[model samples]
Target: MDLMDLSHQNRINTQLSKQKVGKTIYTDCIRAENIKQIVPAITQCIECYPRFHRAENPDICIMVTGIPNVGKSSLINALRRMHLRKGKASRVGGEPGITRSVLSKIQVSENPLIYLLDTPGVLSPRIENVETGMKLALCGTILDHLVGEDIIADYLLYTLNNYPQHRYVQHYELEGPCDNIETLLKEIAKKLRKTQKVTAITGTGKFSEYPDGFLFH
Candidate 1:
């Protein structure tokens, strides 16, 4: 499907033509326009999905890192449906870091060679604040590049809480009830639906009405 088709399918309303922008070749254009609207966000995405270092022959690795149960697996599954491999990345569950020792890599294309890495949830880091900052920066960057700025920020808030002590929360001053991760996931789902232009308050209620195809195109 083209970009427009995907957006229509996902209910994302944007001016960019789906057919023209769907191709990976137009990613730079999307990034340029998006960065103009949200600078820090685009910068973050670039850092997260860094370009191949060696120009002669570079291997691109796109890392998908987020807190547990934040739909990371679901997103990967969706991507896999788009022809990407679902490497043996960690599975989603209440416990963090299920794929502790293994790194799941999905090969998107072979000619240029793109590898998408699903990393372990960022909870208690073996390192310190610096590592957390770097991860948060990369996460923000990736989200902004692919999704949007506000969505990325919201995701960051939801995921960073996975590591209660992560300095990103303090840096952003995100203060709220310390609800469970499930609550945050629901919130993300609700926001995602809204981003797709669905106007439903109770996310569960909307989800329950899936039979009517209320949200799906």
Candidate 2:
């Protein structure tokens, strides 16, 4: 199963179509919490698989795997809540490497007797290009520090401007869309009040500003 943010719906669909994989189901496991679409789809898959039909119980065991910090554990928990009315069977976090090892099967359903095994996220041994690596870093699949925050921030700004996504203009109250990162950062710092006073070498206090992180909302 793959977990994705709905905001990138068009890009996700286009990429998936190029892979030639059949019968893929998309679900917004975190934001929309739409497990209602998943249960029936999973049932249909199991019904079509001949090996499951030969078994007397026909219990289903699904393995959840994806890139780091892509919400495999969150999906398991959501499914359990939807089907069994139970609390979390797995731990969740905002950063990657939260689930380091394979977890034992956790029951999510009773009637067909469904269980899901949560596994650590994996990445390809080789990345095709620099742009792909940066994209992964932006998605939180890779550690931000490894790629350097400045580069990620700059690439993000470039992408936003390339797409001409102007929400940032209104959010930060900028005069208009900007191509310069330094100018945009200053505006953001001022808007968020993230400036601090520090003593200079000449024994004079000077204010330094830093941009604070924010969600698009």
TM-score of each: 0.30, 0.79
Q: In terms of TM-score, how similar is model 1 to the real structure?
A: 0.30
| Tens-digit lDDT string for candidate 2 (91-146) | 99988889999989999888768899999999999999999999999988888889
RMSD (CA, angstroms), candidate 2: 5.2
* Top candidate, metric TM-score: 2
Q: Assess each prediction's global lDDT (C-alpha) against the native.
A: 0.45, 0.80
Query: What is the lDDT, from 0 to 100, of the residue 104 in candidate 1?
Result: 58
Q: By lDDT, who's the top model here?
A: 2
List clashing residue pairs in candidate 1.
Answer: 3-18, 4-18, 44-141, 45-141, 45-142
Give me the runs in candidate 1 sitting further than 4 Å from their true place.
Answer: 1-55, 84-90, 109-112, 124-217
